[model samples]
Every structure is written in structure tokens, then in C-alpha cells.
Target: MAKASRESGTPPVERAARASLHPVPDGRAPASAEAWALIDSARQSYIDALPIAAAVLTEQDGDLVVGASNRRYDSLDAARPASQPMPIIESPTIVRRLLEFFARPGDELRFEWRYGDQVSGRHFHACISPLAQVPGGNGRCLLTLVDRTTEIESTRSLRAELLHDSLTGLPNRTAFAEAVDEVMASNDGARHAVLLIDLSRFSRINESLGGVAGDEVIITVARRLISTLRAGDILARVGGDEFGILLRLANGPDDAPAAARRIQSVLSTPFRLARFEVGIECAIGVALVGEEQTSGEELVRNAQFSLKRAKSTGRVEIHHPGEAACARYKLDLETELRRAIDQGDLRLAYQPIVDLAANRLTGFEALARWTHATRGVIDPGEFIPVAEEAGLIVPLGRWAVDSALATLAKWDALAGSAVPLTMNVNVSAIQLARDDVPGVIAAALATHGIAGSRLTIELTESAIVQDPERTTKALQALKALDVKVAMDDFGTGYSSLSYLRRLPIDSLKIDRSFVSGMLQDRDKVAIVRAVLSLADALGKTTTAEGVETIELSQTLAALGCSHGQGYFYAAPLTADAARDYWQSQL
Candidate 1:
């Protein structure tokens, strides 16, 4: 029991309770003490049935007296000793609000209150409703406290999960946009930029190493990127091997490029993984925030558009005003290209490969051509790279192989084995890296009833140099299938001559740049002669591309080039035209 107040000669709660039970007035019958006790017991019983903590409070002398309460309500102060009376509303702020609610006849007050620390404490939603006034003593109110601690913690955990990336513990794309939104909303005329960094050739790492190694690389990149940022900047893992950075530039848009250079510098050093050390490069794209920007997501999208351009140009690119439309058009084209490949709607054009020495038709190079139903004749230069970047090249390559082989079969039936010509199909690096190229070729050959020797798989130096060991293995597999492998567009990429010695390269297709003006350009002629000399020494055949004139053809033949393909021979033709041309040559 609490000690009495000497001035009042009574305990505070007892005095307040006695003050609340004053006699009734205005012709009302004075209720018996027993009846009043029964009424109080019924109120206690009613509140005890409530799921949450509940109590009936009466206002006395600007303070709340607990007239009746449930056991749950009493448990709120369980830390206090059993000798002391239970306190109704411990928070003075809550008691003040309840007192205010008592003054209003029909008003209800609702609020949230915490029992202890802001972060690690119990939370409760407190609601107080005014009850009918006590007979001339004080107004009464019912207070209920619903514990919201579990619910609040759950919400906090869910929000954290949603906002954070599981792999890197950085902000994800969604959370980055929210942070960008906050920055935009609070912008005080300061310039900002979004830099999207894509780790170059990252898929190759995943292919050469495992996905776990790839994840390690991504985590390392995230950490290094964080090291290059200012205190106010935000960095996020927006993609598998791509990151987005939001910067509040201290010195306008120029700061973005500087930051990009800094990022590159940090990432320049090779990463030491579990097994081996590997080097990496990145392409950065920047989109500056402008007054005309609509939202944060739009800015991030613009940054992505710039990133796409950066991948192609191999430089840091900024988003221009009209780039969005260009990006959308490219997206639409990619969609159409995917649909075209799936439907077998794309066409193949056969360009003749001639025997330069004999001046006779020996084979044809299979070139993929798209004659869009609505937009006629899309250039291969336009869509080929698009297919490679969009990861549609595998299916596109498969379609090309099947179509070309089927065409060859039809031509063979027409020629009746009179002309034994080869069909060369160009293969992209993406196909070699991600697909079973030899298996696909074997299946296509079997399906078309064509011998593997008659099919030549043309590969660019870039394709071979991406993963030399894998490329060598794939080429060896193709060699096992007895398919001729020609290095297409040779001498264009940064391939070492040692690769030529090590790889199972049977023929070299001299790129157009060396063959187009060999007669007029002595340098080009010398390069062609050297390529031919090298091919002859290596026991490999040489084919000259873009030999557009008879004089150039003679020059290449004199240089010991075995085959030639150019405008001088024939342009890429349709299935019927190619058959007619071959028959004419016979």
C-alpha cells in the first residue's frame, strides 16, 4: 500500500476514488452501497472480456482515477510490486488526453504510445471513449490499449527486405527509385546525375567461371563502387552485373564524369577471386536531372538508355533529349526481331563464293536478311548487333542454320549432284559462348541430309578471343564433326598470331577492308599478300572478301587466295536466283 499524503490525510488514488463516488442529485434515488458495488463489478466484468487491456477511468480534480479495470489492464504494470495499487494511465500525456476526452460528451480520442525505448520497446494503440457522466461527481471514459509491437516490427522487417538487395545488401532498383524520388522532391535547384555502370563482358565471366564466382564479382564491384561515392550519393545494384548511382553534384553535371572516372580507376585493378585473379572493365552512362524531368523512375530509365548506347560505342555516353524515343524504337525492333525469329519470318540471302583461280562458282555465304512485313529490307548491320546484345542471337543463329541448310538441300536436288557447293553461315560470339554450337550444326546437318564437310562455320576473331580455351574446345568439337571452320573477318580484332597457330582454323576470310582497294592501296595489297603467305605456310586456304572488281580478283588470285566473295561476283540472292546463278556457272 502507498503511504498517505500528510496534507490530505489520505492516499492519492483512494482520495481520488472517494471523490468519484459522490451522491446522486436532481430527484434521483440514492442508490445503495451494495447496488453501486454490483454496478462496479459488472463494469469490471465487461472490461475483463475485452481482448486488449481495458479500464474505466473517472476524472477527479484534473486527474484520472481507475474506478475499474480488467486483469490484462492490471498486467501492464506487472513490474510494480503487488503491495502497491495499480496505476491506470502512467503517461501524463495520455492522462491529459483522457481528461480532455472526459470533458466532451460524445468525443473519442485515439493515439499511439510506447512503453519504453523508441526502437526496442512495446507499441500500443490507445483509444479512449467518453462514457455517460457519473451522477454529479465526474465524467468517466473507457480506455483500451491494443499492443502493436509485433505488427510494427513485422512491417519494419518487410520494408527492409523490400528495399535491400539480397546479394549485396545495397539498395535494389525499386528502393533506388524511391531514394531518387526523395532527392527530386527535395531538389533546391541543384544539379544531379544518374550513372549506370555495366560490367563489360560480365556474362563471359559467368560462363568461364561459375555463377558463384559471378556473384562474388558483383559483390566486389558493389564494394568498390561504394568506395568511390561521396557521403550524399546513393549506389544500387540495379541489375545482375549493372549498378545505378544517384549523385547530387557539387559542381554541376561535370562531377558525374569525374565520378565515373574514379569508379573506373577503382575497378581497374584485377579482382582476386577464390581460384584466380581476373581483370574487368565497365561502361558508364550518365543522365543529368533536368527541370523537365517527370519522376525519378524516368531519370533511371534515361540512364539505362545511355547505358545501352555506351555498350555499343565503348565510351561514356550522356542521355540526349530524343534518346528515349530511339530506345523505345530499338526495343520495339528487338521485340519484332524476336517474333520474326520465332515465326521463321526472317529470310536468308545467299551470296556466291567463287574460286578466284578457276573463276567458277564453288560455294555461297549464307547471310541473314530481314524483310519486315511492314518495314521492308532492314539492313543486317542494324539488326545483327541488336540480336547479339538482346540475347536473341542463339535462336536467330539456329533459324539461319536450319533455313540455309534447307535451302542448300533444295538447291542440291535441283542441281542433281552436278555441282558440289559449300554453304557458309556466320556465327556470333554470343552463340559460341552460351550455346552448343557444334551440336546444333550436327543436328541441322542430319536433318537436312547434308554432309558436315559441305557446311563451313564462319567465325569472327572477336568470337574466338572472348574465351580462347572454350572457343578452341568448341572448334575442336566442330572439327570432329568434319565441318570446315573459317575465320570470318580476320585481322580486324586484337587476336594474337599465336591463336592462329593453336586454333583449328582451316581457312581465313580476309576482311573487306584489306581486299576492297588492294590495287589502289599498296598497303592493303601488301597486307593481303602477307595474309595469303601466312595462310599458305600454315596449310590453310585463303578467301578474300569485298573483291569488287575483276582486276582485284586477279590480284587476289595471283596472291594465291583460294576463294573470293564480293559485289564483282554476285550480290546476296534469293533461293531461286542462287540456283539459277549456279546453273548458269555450270
Candidate 2:
């Protein structure tokens, strides 16, 4: 009984765990007792030349009971205990599946593993394969290890390229969304905040100094923003010249505002780019994690919503449940306005321009009007900027031109030389910059079979000042078409004499702010008189635009204003009302 007890002293696991040398899977002949010496000699010569070092393991049972490991495998986990598990560490799920593959004797397992310490994370390469020629007979697997820091860096660099902006090295929008998704998926009930930093006038810098300068500005901004945030906070370039920041661990909702303020303070310093020192203004929108928001997409949209509100109201805005409702309203309004433009719900009202010398109606300017099917009247002042921002102005301007020209054609037929009047249509800077504008006007004139002389186009100085080269070209084309061009809001801008001489404009319409206060304000009177004298010297006529009283009208006439337009004659009226007034003037 004592002999039997001594025989069974070792556990079955320990007995099964035996180590033996095996052949390398180098397309090598099987490691028979006869070939061991030859294989060992050839392997030693090339082993150091290659980056890979391989070891063979034998699995005894289905329990991942590893048999023997070669020298290469021993070095990989030299820090691990000899009794510890094989396939040392890395991506857990991948390791588990690879370990389970031992059940199939002849099957191969190929995978890469990463293992390291705190200072150097996951910087190893490993691949495993099976080479057993017989079922359950010396079942074997091969593992290879490589420690190439260059390979590690190359892989990391490729990954960074995939996820980061090429110019600024900030995470791109896709990576940013993934981060937001990760935060939301944690579901640990920790509050998070997303802040969208929108440059209010980034386009001005782009247009002024060229796109190269714009790119430098974006890179500079990204570096400054990274420095502004805590180590846990994430900054990404989510748009052209727009940045998004995520507060990874926020104490409360107020953390978002404090972060924004710090960033704003940092940006208060000017960015020196090449030859120019530039300062930029930014509008910030913030959204905080709460019970109501459940997804990253929702959080991003809420931040964008806050951004729009901030831009509109000129302040930093935070997302509230009410903000969503307001966003829905704004989106609804934008969609309806688009449809209103396309479906002809937009129309024009005509206001008279009278000749002060003859005291007769000379022409009428067309002003845009819109009425909602459910909401009654919408003011132009409220919606015009919206139209401009949406790029709906070009289409809107075209429609207005067609409508005014068609009405003028009918009016000309009715008047029949008794009270022929010109038609004036307003054009926006968006339309002026377009190469198609002159073609549109030419088509409208042809469609109505009307003379271009009967059409007068009005433009503000701001419209002409931007993109002067393009503006001058469009004006030259209009003059070629024989249409009169009037610079509206003349004295309100810094209009250079050289600018006026460069274009073929016909008249100046003095801004009402000056005209309305001219009687009581000497500075206003001087501006009016100076504008009138300048127009005369330039051989261009002057139209006093806000003659609300008879005294103002007579004063404008005494100041040698060529025409007068405003409530002194009449407010803007309907087309039929305008027609009747022109008929009565005859």
C-alpha cells in the first residue's frame, strides 16, 4: 500500500504537463530523432537575423493544458511565473478563442497579441499556429514574438492618420462621435458636457488672406484649445474652422461654461499667422448630459441647436428641453420659407419714386412680402437675413425680378404713353457676386418683351464693396444690357470716389437715417448736401429716400435732390394700388 501511494504521489495535471523539444514550422522536415541536429544548426544561423522567435507548445487535454514552450516563448513572459497560463496577455476575447482552438488537433491559430507595462502599453507582436500531424499525438502549436518599437510606432501613426485632421491633428468628426458614443454608453449616470465652438466670422479670414492662411489659423486654434482644457477633456475639429470639446469628467453642468470662459480668455490674445496678426471671435453652444438625452447623436444635435441660438441672440446658450422645441420651430420655419420661395407664396409691394421737379410719379421700387398660410404676415426685416443665410436670396431675388418685370410690362401696355413708369428691383450681394445674374436679368427682359431702360436695379454699398472685381464685372454687364443701376444707402457707407468712378452706376439714394434727421441735425444736413454735391460733380443724380414730411420734401428739392421717394408721396402699396396711383397722376 505504501508503494502504490508513492506511485500516485504526483497530480495528473502535473504529470500531463511535460516539456519536450519540437521541430520549428519553417517548412522544416518533421523533428524526427534523426533530423534534430541538422535543424538546430540551420535555425541558429538565421534565428538572430529575423525579428520573429518561435516556440512550440503541446496541449494535452481540452482544458488548455499547455505542454512545453521553447526559448522564444519563455522570453515573452519572463516576468510571469513559470506556472502561470500561456498566451500571456492582450485583447481577452481574442486570447480565449485562440486558446479554445486546441480542441481541434490539426487546426491552426493565427493572431497578434500586445503585452507591456505602465510606461509602455501594448507594444509586442505575437502569432500562434498549430502543427500536429497526428490526432492527440504530441499535439503542438507555434508562437512567435517580436518587439519592434518602429512597427509599434508605424501602426500608431497609421491609426492617428485615420482618426485625426491632417492639418490640425485634432480628432475628426467621426472620432469625436465615437467618443461621445463611448461616454453615453458607459451609462454610469455621470454628467458630461459637449461644447461646440463656432467662429462667428471665420470666412472673413479665409476670404481676406487666402485659404492657406485660413489653414494656419485652424492649426493654431487647435493647439491653443488643447492647452485650454483639462487632461481628461477631449477637443476635436468637427467642422471647417469649428471645434467641439467634450468634458470627460465634469463635476456639474457649470463646468461647461467655465471651460468656455477659459477658452475665450486664451483666445483673447491675437494669433500671429505669417505676415498678419489676427484676432477671431467665437460663439459657443453647450449641452449637458441629463436623464432626457440618451444618445451621442442627440447630444451633438443639442449642442448644434445651442450654437444656432447663440449666433442668433449674440450670447452663449445652453441646451434646455425648451431649446429643442425652439429648434423645431426654427427648422420648421426654414423649411416653410424654402417652400414659400419655391411655391410662389412670396410677393412684392411697390412704393413710388417721384420726380421733385415735375411732381409726378417716375417709377416704383418693388419690396418683397410673404404671408404664411397659418401665421398671417411675416416681416421682411425678420426673414431677409434668414433668406441670405440659407442662400435662398439668389432664388428669391430672381423671382422678384420676374414678377416686377411682368407687372411693368402690363402697366406699360395700360399706360400707353400717358404715364409710362420705370420699375426698380432690389438685388442682394449674394446675387451680385453670381455670374448668372446678368443672364437672369436679360432673360426676364426678353420674356416680358420689355426694354432694359424701363428696369432700374438697386444695390446697397455693402453689396458692391465685397468682391469688387466681380461686382464691377456684373455692373458692366448690366450697363451693357442698358439697365440703370442705383447705389442705395449711399452716405451710410464709406464709399470711395475711386470706387464710384470704376463702375457704371447711374444714381445715389441717400440713406433715410441722414434724411430723417437732416432738418434738426446740422451734421445730417451737411452729409445730405455733401452727397448731393458729390453726385452732381460725378454727373450722377441724387434721390432723397425718406421724405416723410412736405418740409423734408421741399428741403430735399431746395438742396438740388433730383428725386424724392417715401411716405411724403405714399407708403409701399399693392400692384393694383400702384397702378391706380400712376393712372391718377396722369
Candidate 3:
């Protein structure tokens, strides 16, 4: 047989191919001459059809002989002549290296190699695999060349889409959630930290700047978070204007607070969006993952709860799931609350709302009291919100209304005369939201044989503001039937002036916070004055609550606040005690 032609130089592409076709120990017999010829012919055909250069090599005595070459391969290797034999020993140093790789005994090897000194480019992922056995003693290797630059570029594009936010090109929620899950699964028992970030007053930004600017703010926030986080940490947008972060492999609980402080530092900077420079502070809730026995869902929930607690306490950040006390206290309270409402353990204590000018009892505000069969006289503050959260407020409100009406009827029959008495009952938001509230009130009034005017309904600022349009319509139906509407706990919320003007309110009760501080604080006095002025402007009356001391009562009267109710007049009394107290006063 003619000596196989040796290309003078092996390019990086050819070298990579030779490396992939390391000798294998399959122990199969070598192909016969006729079969070898057919295989070489097929290899030639495959090389010819390829878009890039290709070649085949045979290892003989630690030297590579070029068995075949495509037209592109011949063009790239200018030292080679078609159908001419060249000695491998006379070729360049790179050809020697290619021959050495094929002579080695192994299955495969892969590596990246570069070519062309001036216009050099990096080609990745050259692989080698055994093609067939050698003719006499050992198996021969078949090598093929591939240019992986295009495939690598395509892979880069896909990775960008998979890991980044489409709008801002920042790492997205998917990447963030995966990072958190991984960190939580780590074997290191050290605490991990999760930061729950919520934009304070973002609704105002959305409303004022429109959604486009709002999106820009979100993008800006994403960038800020990226800059704030370490390499292993992750940040994601969980809700509108809400972001979550996970810090992996944290040192301890001490590390979490430091991380939170660092995040705060970044967020406190001003952001310029659509020509408006707005500063945002993140309400951060930090929860230690390993210590809390937390899963992904539990960690997020605890962080959110901590964030709420932080915001309520006027802090920028808070670490929560801190102790089991908070969650346990809440659960215990919820259980007691449900039991109290269901088992008739809840009671109503009637506080006399005196007409200060006449010293006569007009009506009573039915204050909620929980006489826990075990815990005695639980404060309304302790259980009222629990009831609301448990969705028991509707039933509880109905009970209070019905009981107050019945008490009014009983006192009337015992005193042997109908004292022009109006019973004031507090209503919750859920109660007002119910479509049956009006009918419930009417039925209670009819059952007591009392006119609608004898029932004065008190609603907190939140109840009316929850859904003002629907609540106003409901209140209008109640007003049409001559039921008096009073906005209770006034001057403690937003839109108080708007509420008094829009709703068909008969009176406004100044919140005790403002009344109690009125004697010493000018701002409290000013708030009370402003409320009274607003009520007067709307042609509504005012009641001052928390008139505990004589000084507070005298000061409230001096401020032109007429109706007063508190321990100064009489502490909340039982129905029978209220009847006797009213009789004594009369």
C-alpha cells in the first residue's frame, strides 16, 4: 500500500479530533481489506458533506498518517498536496502533538484549542472517540472535527433567558426561589436568613406616576438589590412592590441582622424615576431558616409577619419567628376568641353615654367583655381583633345588638315606663358587609317594640373605610329608617374629614387617644379642635370618649365637645346595674 500522506501541520480542530478518538480495548477483530476500503469511502463522503473542515488519521508507530481529507481541510492545511505522500516525521511540531494523542491508549478525551495567530478565536468542546480496530495487533482511532463556537453562543442566549428578568435583565424569581431552596437544603446546620422586602407607600407611587413609571421603579429596585446582595445570595419579586431574598450559609442569627442593615443602606438612597426623585424605605422582616424549623412557605410567612410587626412598631427592619411566644400567643388567643364567641362566654357591658349638659342618660355604648369561664374579664383589645380575623365578628356584632335591644325592653318593663332611651351598639366591618345587617337590625327593633331611632349604631373608622361606596349605601339604608349613625374612634385614621362629609353620619366620637392626651399635649388638643370644627362644619354632633378624670372632662367641655363617656361618668356596667344606675341618676 502507498504510504499515507501526512499533513505538514495539524490545526487545533484536527488535534481536538485526534484527542477524541483514543484507542479502545473492545477486543474485536480488525476489518478485512475490502471492509476497510468501504469504511474509508464512507468517511470521505461524510467529510465532503460537512460545512466545516474535516479529516481522518491513522496511528502507525507513534506517527499520524492522514487517511482522508475534505476539500475545506486541504484548503486550511496549505502544506499538503492532494494524492501526494508526506512523511509525518518531517511535519511541524503541532502535527507531532496530534500524532502522540492518537498513539495513547484510552477511550476519549476533550479540550478547547485555539488557532490562527492574528485572527485567533476560541473553539470549545472538541471530543475524541474510537472509530474502529487497527489492521494487525491494536485498534485504530477515527477522529472527527466540530466547530462548537455557534452552539456555545446559542447556549449563552438560552441561559440568559432562563436566569434573568425579561424586562430588567436581572435575576428573576425562578433563580431566586431555586437559590433559596438549595440553601435551605444545605447540610450546614447554621442559620440561613430570609429578607422580606415590601415597598412602603408604593400604591401612591403607582397612582401618581402611572404603571410605566411604576415598572421603572421596580426595575431600579431590582438593580439596587443585585448590587446589595452577595454572590451566593438571591433576590426576587414576589408580589407587586414586594421582594424576597435568601442569604445562604449564614454564620448565625447575628449575620442576619447585619445583612438586613446592609440592605437598608442600599434602599435608603433616592431613586430618580421619570423626573421625580423618590426615596423608598424597605420594611424588612428577617427570619432565620434553620433555627425556626422552617420550610420555604413557613420562612416566607414568618418573614411577612415580622415585616408587619416591624412596620407596626415604626422600625425599618425586624427579625421574627424570634420566639415561639408571638405565634403561640396569637394561636392561644384565637382559640379562646372562637370559644368565647361560640360558648356564650362573651358579655356586653353597657357604659352610660350621659348628656353632660343635662346630666341625663341618653343611651349606652355596648362594650364587649369576655368572661372566659377560666380567665375572667378578658379585655376587648385582647379578643376583638382575634374575632375579626377569625370571621366571628359578624355573629358577635349581631349578638351585641340583639342583647342591647332586649336589655332596653327589659329595663322599660321593670321601670314601668318607656324612658326615651336609645341603645348604642358597635358594628364591625364584616357585620356591615353582610347583606342581612339591615334586616337583622329591623328584626331586633321589632322584637323589642322599639323604634329605629332608639337604636344608635357606632362604626369604627376602619369599618366605613374598608369599602366606602358599599358601606355608604348600607349606612344610607339604615339612615332612611331613622337609625342614627355615629363614626366611632375618630381622629385616629386617614380620611376622617372625608368620612364625616360623605357618610350620613349623625355624630363623631373623638378617639380616646386624642382625648386622653388633650390635657397636656397641644397637638392632641388641636386634633380634637379640628375634629370638632369639622363636625360643626358638617352639622354633626361630637362625643368625647376616655373622659377618665375630672380635669379631662372639664378640658373636653371647655373645648366645646358636648357628649362624654368614660369611667368619669360611669365604668361599663352590666345591664341590670346600668338600669339601677340610670334609675338613681333620674
Candidate 4:
């Protein structure tokens, strides 16, 4: 029991036994055999070992006296203490320094230091408490050495992995978020800027050369950016090809663009990769943190909004109140459009397409319309682009097609085959990109029992040219179903007569710009003539849009335009007016 207590640990009863060199008197010993046996079976553990490098040092004199120590004390510093009763200071210089911490009356002090390279992987933390008061009232102290090298190293490694980009050694998005919040919360009344540098067409490097070369380009960009920025600026790789920079203590909001311009100027130079000279373009969005932008998320969101504009215009965009309002309006329109769609608040306006040669109605192009009870009518020019960007164009386009088909079926029912008219529905590029467009159109036609020949699908030349293979395939499938396809806004897109020859298009609609300008501009007149002649040669029908006067209508008819659609025929009318128009025309 005594051997166990002596070897167990350092505690009050064990510490009391080491108070004096001599044994305690018999009367002072506990009255039980268990207690006497504890002291009689073994020597005090404290005096058994010297105190320099123990897990705990009980007491020390100016001369380095005895104390309780674990088995570590003997092997520490790789030196054993003297067998004679002597101070540890007489043993080694390192031992003397360890005992010196508790020599004076002071609070506990923590120490971390290393010895020579002999204990390379080990770190010693010395916790020294001077003149510790024990139950026996001895003038003792405690000193402990703990090894925590692995723990500290692991913590540091984890932090670095979480906060830094491995390849570039730049701070990652996590670090950027924290920095943005800290800067926003600082409230130092100094403007800070966040610029998102997005590399345009950066994938060309990987596609043209390889991914390794792409990595080289990324590193080169990182180095160029770091060199271009001021010392206090921060640069981080927040995305694969996007770099985020935080400019602290900007002089004004203009400082953001000025800093971005400097970095952009540096990046404008071509990067010389292995066996390739690659040029790069960057779209920079600069957002200044202020009262409205209160967080990293808001800052990045505003910057992203600016980036979209920068990508289009190929210039730097500073986030302003106007752009913020525009972004908010787009979001508002998206919500309202979704509601309009779900509630069937959307309607179609029909603009009459006239057969000038026959002097009668040929078809009507269905235009989608939306009117908010509070805000009045929303223009298709505004909402259509917004819809496309939001990926809502496909759904809205399908609905418009379905509703128009059903309306056309009703019109045919009312007409009773007297002059059965074709109805045209415009399709966006996003709609045609889907493989299900043919299926959707077929379903709508079958649901209404409308002939595909009486339904013309008018699409912008640009939309068809975007993805020629997929679009051409979709168009061919429609043609297989006996649907007629017309290239709307023909001259505005980059497609040539050769491209038109490759597709199974039935007609070309001359863009309104040319039709509206042909009377004034000779080039417009020439473009009109050329489109008409080309259509006649290709055995395709021609439709002249934006005909506003009788004279212009006569000129287009003489120039071989088979159909015309504009204000001259009739403005776009509501569904009720359209139903009344077919009745009146009869």
C-alpha cells in the first residue's frame, strides 16, 4: 500500500511525507495499520528522485533542494543526479535554470523553450508555481514540464489548410469571407474595396494546351497580381479563375477602380507559356463597402452584379446605386413574372401579318404581354432579357406557344375555314436549346388539333446560329412534323446566305431596322432589296416588318415582299379585340 502510494502520484498526504528529511514520530502517524503500512512499506517518492526535469517539482531551495519527480527526471538532459544530498544547480547548467524560476516570490509563470538539437521533435512547457502552500504548511513549489509540440503543429496545419489555397498559397473564400466581415464591422469610416477579377476565356489555355499549362497561367496571374497591388492589399483565389482582392483604407470610392485599373494594366500583357503565347482578358468588378453593403455576402453580390456588366462591356464596373436598383428590379421582375405565370396573368397580343399581294389577312404573330396591377404594363424587351438570364424564358416561351396554339385553334373554329390563318410564335435561343422543344410543340399542337403547317415558328437569326447543330436538329424535327420555320430579324444576326442554305427554313423576315430605314437610307434600301432577291432565288417567302406607311408598304410589295406586319396593318390588339377583328374582317 505504501509502495503504491509512493509511486501513485504527488498529492497532499504524499507531499506531507516529504516535508522533512527525518521520519514522522509514531504519535503523529495515522492510527490504522493501513496508514502505518503505507509509510513503512516504501520510501517517500519525492526524495527518491531529483527535481530538475520531473513532471512536477515539489520544492526547491536557492541551492536546488529535493522535490517529488516522476521517472522522467533521471533521463532528462540525459544526466543522473548525484547520489549525495546536493543541490541540482551543482549538476548541470540546464538543471540550474529550471530551478531558478521558483526561487523568488512571484506568481506561476509558463515557459516554452527548447534545449539543444538533441530533443529535436520535443517541446517543453515549464509551468512554475512558486511557494505553493500545501496541507503540511511546507515552503514548497511546483514545476511541471509538458510536451505539446504535436498538438500545436496539428492546429497550425489545420488552420492553414482551411484558410489558404493550396496551389497558389493565397487565402481562400473562407478567409475572404472573414476578412470582409471584419472590414465591414470595423466601422472606421474608411472606404474599403472588393474587386473580383474574373478571367475571360481562361479555359482556352487548358483546352488549347493542357491543365498543367493552365495551372502555370493561374500561378503567373497570381504573381502578377501580387506584384501589381500595394503592400497592404489582399489577394485571394475565391474561385477557379476568379481572384478577389480587398483594398483596405481606400481614399475614396474611386480608389477601387484605380486599383483595379493598375492590376488590369499589369495583366494585359500576354503570358508566355510553354510553346504557346496566351493572351487573357479580365472583367473586373469593384464594389466599395459602405452603409448599404454591410457584409461580405452583400459585397460579393454587388460585385457579381457589376461583373455581369463588365463581362458584357469589357470594362471595369463600379457598383453604384443605379446598378443595385437595376439588380433589385430584375429580381423583383423575376418574382412577379413567376407569379404572373402561375396565376395565368400573362396574355397574348396579336399583331396582324398581311398578305399584301392578296390584300387580305395571312397570319398573326402572337406577342406575350404582362401587366402588373400596380406597375402597369411590362415591356417584352425588358422582361424577355430578364427572363432569359433567369432561365425562365423556356417556361414562359412554352406557355406562350401553348396559349397561342389554343387561341389559333379558337380563331380557326370561328373562321370556319373561310380564310384559315397561320399563327406565328417566337422562340428564344434558350427554348430551342432544349431537346424537349419538339415534344412540347407537338403536345401543344395535338392538344389543340392544330395543323403544324398553320403554325409558324419565328426565331431570331442569332438564336439559331448560337448552337447550330442542336438548333438545326431541333428545327429539322419540327420540319418533320410539317412546321414552317422563319428566321426573324434576319439581317441583324451574323448568319450568311450560305448558313440559310444549309437549314430547312421556309422564309426570312426582314428586320424592322431595315424596313424602318429603307425610305431614308440608301444602304437600308439596298439591304431590303438584297434580302428580297435572295429569298426569291432560294424559293423562300419574304416578310417585311415595321411597315408604317402606304408608300413604304407599296415599295416593299413592289420589291417582292410577299407579306408585311407593322402599324400600317394594325397595332398589336388584345385577345378580345383580335376575336372581334376576324369577325369584322369577315
Q: Pick the candidate with the highest lDDT.
A: 1
- The best candidate in terms of TM-score: 4
Q: Write the per-residue lDDT of candidate 4 for residues 35-80, one digit (tens) a residue.
A: 5345433434553454445533433223344344555654553442
Instruction: Give every collision pair in model 3.
Output: 20-128, 20-129, 21-128, 21-129, 134-139, 134-140
Q: Which is the better candidate, 3 or 4, if ranked by lDDT?
A: 4
Ranking by lDDT: 1, 2, 4, 3
Residues 1-586, candidate 2: write the lDDT tens digits. Answer: 0010111123333433321143345645444543544444453344444556554444443333333344554465565433344345323543464456655545565555545443354455556676644332545565556666578778877987988988887899989999998988987425678999988678999999889889988888888898888867889999997899988645677788889898888777888877788998789999988766778988899999899888898778898876666666767778889999888888899999999887888999999998999988988986787888778888999999999998888776776742478899999987777537889999999998888888999998988888788888888899999999999999777767888887898999999999996899999999999999989998998898888999988888888999999997999989999998887888
TM-scores for candidates 1 onward, in order: 0.69, 0.61, 0.58, 0.71
- Candidate 3 on 1-586: residue-level lDDT in tens? 2234464255434543443343324655443545544555576698798776656566666545665678766765553333323332233433544555566746665555433322334343444456666433334454445666567667877986887767776566667666666666766524567788888878888899998888888898888887878766777776778888787644666767777778788888888986789988778777776466555656666777788877777565555444445766778988878776778877789998877666677889888888767767777887887778777888888898888898898988887878867789989877788646777888888988888888899988888998998888889889877899998888776755667777899999988988886778998888999988888888988999988988887777777776899999899999889888888887
302-385: candidate 1 lDDT, tens digit per residue: 898889889999889888887777777788899999999888788999999999889999899999999999989899999998
Model 1 global lDDT (CA atoms, 0 to 1):
0.84
What 10-residue stretch in candidate 2 is worst by lDDT? 1-10
